[model samples]
Target: MATAAATIPKDLSRLEAQAAGVLSPEALAYILAGAGDAGTTRANAAAFRRWKIKPRKGRRPRKVDLSTTILGTRMPAPVLFAPVGVQTLAHPEGDLATARAAAELGLTYLHSTQAAYKMEDVAAANGDGSRWYQLYWPTDDELTKSFLRRAKAAGYTHLVITLDTTLLGWRPRDLDRGYSPFLENKGIANYTSDPVFQRKLVAPANVAPLPAGIIFSGVFQNPGLSWDQLPLIRSSWDGPILLKGIQSPLDAKLAVEHKIDGIIVSNHGGRQVDGAIASLDALRPIVKAVGNELPVLFDSGIRTGRDVFKALALGADAVLVGRPYLYGLALGGQAGTHTVMQRLVDELETEVRKAGRRSHRSLSRSSLIRTP
Candidate 1:
């Protein structure tokens, strides 16, 4: 059965331009710009353009099905709102707007460990919407356990352990402007609200009095983190575990060996590395490594429905959208977020049908061709 057309402005380019008027210059540049010289950032979108779909003709009159299930949770599209932190910089409502929007759309949203609001509040906004918790893996064991415990209690269905960012990367754009959201205590509501983290607070906790790095350094990134520590998180979070930022086939295989539930093929949306390979370029091998064993959620370089379709064809079970919805939120709040996401789903279903595929799960490498 055909669904109604997307209600809001689905055109990303137009929506983004509209957002520029609504957001601050610092916020605008921060979300759009990438790391270092931004070569890999450009490459993410460029890589998609290099590949063309080999259209299959003479399809039957059957309608395409965009419905899919991940970890047994059924969704209307093979898409999820990726965990993008510090959303308060984009909108006052922050993760709450996102949570409410996802719930209304029946879409799955991954809540960031560093979200601006407390996890419980975001969960309340979700109101039975399927959601996952993305863990940054704080160095403090008890603190980490506290976060996991709260998420499980909040109705989060999965745990996404982000593994690649042991330390923040060199992003020239943010550096040039002396803009760091953490330093402002913008996205640490989850941490600050935590009883464990609050107990560690000393000399009073305020954004201006102390830099976030000073307080968060110990807990933010554990450079020494390795597979040895995976058990710690596993023991804490009993639900499904997905290790985000697995770019290599070896890492994908290792995750399977570690008995992980899924791996998000990402390069932190070209924010972590300067000259890294495009995430889509890295997806094929990782999928080849362990696509059958666990779900491979692809992130980075996804701006449109065609991008989502291309990622699905390349091997991702589902794709995560990062910045676009934030742009929408900047422009129109919860309604904007819903419109952008729904637009992507609308476009993805349109792409699946155009490529002559019945279901998104049926999309394969044969559906696309890499152009020279």
Candidate 2:
């Protein structure tokens, strides 16, 4: 259905540019915008350029094992679809298309709390795929619990609590265009479907998008959220709980102190802070701090398979690709998303072979050298 009008790009590098031709001005700006000046976004790509992969001599194995397990969830490759909200902005199928693609590819798909479709619908499409739910941690406790319960019931195996977006960042592009998807009620399906959330509404979300959107923005995040309150979530969720938006070694230690399952080193893809440290630059220290106590996943500025290789070499157990796959969705819907992600995995494997590595486990800090 997605590929009917357009031929999906195989090169992958040309995805965003091609997608620009297809996306509306508003959708394009919202999807591509970074906070403030987008300096951190630029740094994300620049950080990857600072590392040079060191190919081994005559030690390449004939076969590479890209498969791995994250907190007991098995994935065919080290790549995961980072939780991207409002996918409907890019494709009509939205999370459903991505979920089906992830299921078919045997990769993990992290569904966002701000998803365009309700959790159950995406799960139905996912059909027992390795899926995780990324939470925005609403101010209302019941709403938070309701979201987790829905996710668990729908077969999502993990919980990723995004700590950065307690308040939406000052994105200049969106502001310049006087656009906000939430205001348009574009990504409120999860909330609109929630029983707890409904009690707070005067009218059904579908019937009252404007009002529902206003309430969503108000309750979307808890600025007062603290480490001590993590147990509230842990008690509600039985699966592995990973804290997304972790950028500091001190915070990584704190996650260990809180007995969290894992930490994703991300700056919310540079969408939250304009001058924040690049996620890749932050990975090595966070990995060093946490060691093997918890899995360290990475996202932000991961544009290609080589970027994935760089992340693993820097000690990330696995990596998540966000914008790249969304670009795929923008261009070809499910097939486009699949093609982009598959290309990443394929390129990652090719990079491993070229770098004389045999397995994701074989990658280490020695496999790369920091460029001056």
Candidate 3:
């Protein structure tokens, strides 16, 4: 018997088909599942559908400039590849392929602290392209410092500190599978590379399994972290720092008080809290609270070009897409990922012209109409 070929569609729908063909049911569920009843996940998409673009006439441009500079770095489009962990489970190349695709497209790629590939490997693959590092704030302060030092040394210009997931949320799929990829040694690149983390381990030569207590200790030990610790991270890192997982307007105000470079308005893709407001719903107020003092980026529930447009119109300077690209990776590795990204850029460009806008600069909240 022979394995079936993974189907590749010319568009985003291909990603769905490819995922179906290539991914096992467990893998698919792990990637796609949401928290609790999954109402928030559905709400994220529904929010995008609720906002319709208000097109203008006789204002089309011969060329549309999709490029924008974010935190002193130029990106071909406002879209960035958001950091997601444990790619090896989806594809053989893992983060390396995703980095290559982002580099080729001249877009920013955010590499997760929990990436299957180490920071240096992804940075090397990036090769002068724009790449940012996402940190999970390890239980050990020394381990955290070590990861930041390595990221800075690797030429990653931006550091995104993910404030969510200090504790993992209720994910039914993972629960059903008895699956936590982290426990399987999947998304432990930064940890495995950390001198501090390694110090806690028995000698590598001995090949003894890490004690269950030790494993749980590292996993659940970050609850003492507080907002005051932002200064500690700033003191250790020497680049632009972004605070991810911010949702409230008040928190947005506080992030500016902390003097972070950017704020990612996110709800951990509704994975952390089930009834939390959709990221799209939360973006405008945060942008308003920051009041142009800092860039407000957004993530969660972005699926298509129109969704990107909706985000920008609502107040996001740029958008981070997580699962969509992962779907592409699961389906076709680098090519699949590249196609999905390009499709978004292409759609945005088309929609821009159709709406009589030449650049992202002209897009405003006025360009969107809310559903009745």
Candidate 4:
């Protein structure tokens, strides 16, 4: 009889393969797809290998401090669940299971605008856990305000507005299967449940999938969105605002100039842009631009503890992990999600201790050397 550990592979890649075996071909493709030829998606992982961690020769610290606070949220570790939508495809519980796991672990859970479950229900599932709301700004101002109001009332204390996905990317995998969960009303729980959105529906019968999906599609993206609209968000939600999807130092500088609370240096996990710069390669320059003016969070291509370590050394205050945990959720639901996160946190502690350091805070560019 083999133990669970003996049966399940610890390698993240193998874990993803296991998940692929469990998920439907359509679901797997949607979860795995990157824009166009996936050039940037591939680059995100490659950028991590371009640097080598430099271990200092000295007495190793017996304990490492992984705790950090971002935008007033106290976390046990500097990790947050990246807002992945349509989670029901991986598991029936979807965001509900992930929310519970985040609560148990005391890590921040970022609820997606396109979440499979309603925000209020997900919040309830999260219990007293710290949660941040990720908004995919809609075309309607009232609907946007409604989402902000609801999230705040539901106990979400921070606002993360994704800036890159003003328009959906040309995802070949999703397109190939003609499978967009949103079109099927799979990820529109937030919209369907919203009072503002409901009022826009011509009739109660129109609230069903086909009609509601059309309404959702109409307001989902605002490609004409501009910097001038930031004030609307500021007015609608009274919380720390973090602008995600920024990869350019100029944009980071602009975020500072706009008085935004923080910036997440990302490229939407390479789902938005095909040949965009790897988010890791973009981190240092953006951090250089922002300085200590605002917190700089990182995402995209973060797959391992060493990846988190590298991001911190390059100047990210924290990192948002996406694919790895979702694969865990696919494997064993909530327990698997918790296990994957714990492993990452534990590995991060190991990395800090082995490098002869005691805290992630002590890591800096000096801890790594750029490789050829």
Candidate 5:
């Protein structure tokens, strides 16, 4: 007897609609909305439609291996959860649920510096799961080093330093609602719980709302941070440090010269700049510029498995998925996120089979054909 595959929604639109049913209206806007007119956000997915995969039928590999050890870590698939903060806005469990889900699936869970749950708590929930920490680079030197030290101690294998979002883009939606998650002191778990941040406090953080400047430093960015300052992290951390939010081929080349271990060619998921270059379009140039000096991961506008395929074909070593799993978290918590990732991995497997490739790594620019 032929067994049926577990039915999950293949269409992301359908899954998103389901997520919306359970999520607050404010959260829906925050997760889905982008900067300014949001041209870049929409374009991120639409740009995938521009490239077509040239498949080889009736030539499937004897066995398909979606598992990748390429990142020098044990990731069952190349797809990883992009570091998104304020996950509590989607569900009560927040980063813990997402982390647990990723751990169960043997996927890497890269959590945000501004996550609602403390790093220690999220790590506890993950329970031997592969995990990574992301940094937003606060202005204070000791605070930054404090973060790096804590993550290293907490069993995180990789350090993903976000390069964009130094000042935060002019996000019209968040501004219109006058909702600054940081100002509300939401998503500052990693900061507020840290000794360095606590020592500098004039009074208890809960006594009164912090000034905007403190919130930015204690939870988020330092636009003044520069290339000369990057070595601080390299010197402090022991594991591979990946710079996320790289876009330019020139900057990608510079990243290599700077001795960055890896670069994620992203534009903050089109949230930082309106009319930013679609990350997919920028991937080729950056890959060409740096070649194989370091791993080039891709993010921004990865909604489907075919989208994942396009990124791999275009030269992305792996792809980061953000909003989709967030949507899943909004809809079903840990189970929801697990289901969403499983579907995407299943879809990627189907893509690999259809392309007649043994694994995602074998895919290259030659596997694609540009259509007029």
Candidate 6:
């Protein structure tokens, strides 16, 4: 009889292929497109190939230990689900289904600020599983405070402040499709539930109908946010806080000075600044700058178990996968997400054994070699 684990899909690329089949061309392109020339996206993948792993000979590998602890929480693997909003476009169940899959897999799932379901609903789906909330930092101070309070109350253990997206990127795919999910009220969960957002509307004297599309436009941008305001966020939350878009070493040093718990080396998956350094290329210097003072997590261009291993070897304590699992969700909703997670875990286990390492601690800088 086939074991339960054996029945799950073993190839992540297969999930990607399935996603390609299922998702509309516009949806697929919207999620996959990078800003401007898209050179950074291609560069991210190429950087991984430049580094080659040097395997040892005459070593016997018996068991692999993939379990790791991040931000004081134990996870079965070093992979975390990166936040992707407006999942409803791919599936009816949306973020709720993705949350359930993450909970079952013992991995951390970061819920996006622009999620389809409300934070509380995603939390309910998580049901005691480790979760982190990503915040967009609204332009209004009161509104930002309200969101922070609600996220904490909703059981999010970590607060990921996304510093990358002050405005939407010039995504040609989305622009060509004339697709703006926000304008259609697709990924506006936090906005709809916000108290300050609610206040913008003039309620009828005797319970009259609300005005048309007035609430969304009022709470969209935060032009005045500067580094000075970060302290207010720190004051509001009593949990681990991470600054998510640090690509430069100097910024990494500044984040450490702020006493933030962690920093994610990201380029918003190449969706923010065109021609920004590929995140993988930027990881080494940032890790060196922090110099063991803070935990550095990496994202962008992480698609396979080999990529995960390479990231760990390159000083990333953990890695966040964005489009790969989104592909999974698009292909089969909850089951698809589970399949993608399992394939990644399996590949990591296999690679760990092949590398002749017993645990993550043993696989360090010495375990990797750069391709000439």
Please give each candidate's TM-score.
0.94, 0.97, 0.94, 0.97, 0.94, 0.92
lDDT (10s digit) by residue, model 5, range 1-372: 011112235686476677777778778878877889899988787788889989686877777888876458878889989999999989999999999999889888997998999899999989899998999998888989999889988998899989888888888888888777777777887887899888876766677446633655544667787899977887899888889999998888888888888999998788998988788889999999886799999999888888899999999888899999888787777888888888888888888888988898889998888774
Q: What global local distance difference test value does model 5 have?
A: 0.84
Off by over 4 Å in 6: 1-9, 202-218
Ranking, TM-score, top scorer first: 2, 4, 1, 5, 3, 6
Q: Model 1 over residues 167-284: C-alpha lDDT tens digits?
A: 8888888898988877777788888888888777774456333544467766897788989898788788788888999889999999999888888999988888889999999999
Candidate 6 has a TM-score of 0.92
Work out how many backbone clashes candidate 3 has.
0
Q: Model 1, residue 4: displacement in angstroms?
A: 16
Candidate 5 TM-score over all chains jointly:
0.94
Worst 10 residues of 1 by lDDT: 1-10
Q: Candidate 5 at residue 332, lDDT?
A: 74
lDDT of each structure? 0.85, 0.89, 0.82, 0.89, 0.84, 0.81
At residue 174, what lDDT does model 5 achieve?
Answer: 81
Position 79, candidate 6: lDDT: 90
Better of 1 and 2 by TM-score: 2
Per-candidate count of clashing residue pairs (backbone under 3 Å): 0, 0, 0, 0, 0, 1
Candidate 6 lDDT by residue in tens digits, 1-372: 133234334665455565777788767777778988787888888888888777778685788888888879798899999988888877778889889999999899899988988899999999988899999887777888898899999999999988887776788878888777776667886777666776775762124223413455555556566789887897899999998988999999988887889999999889878877779889988888994998899999887888888888888988999888787777677877777777887888788788888876577767788875
lDDT of 6 at 58: 63
Q: Which pairs clash in the backbone of model 4? A: none
RMSD of each: 2.8, 1.6, 3.0, 1.8, 2.8, 3.1
The better-scoring model by TM-score among 3 and 4 is: 4
What would the per-residue lDDT of candidate 2 be over residues 257-368, giving only the tens digit for each residue? 9898999999988999888899898998899899679999999999888889999989999999999888888888888888888888999998898877678788888889
* Pairs of residues at least 3 apart in sequence or in different chains that clash in candidate 3: none
What 10-residue stretch in candidate 4 is worst by lDDT? 1-10
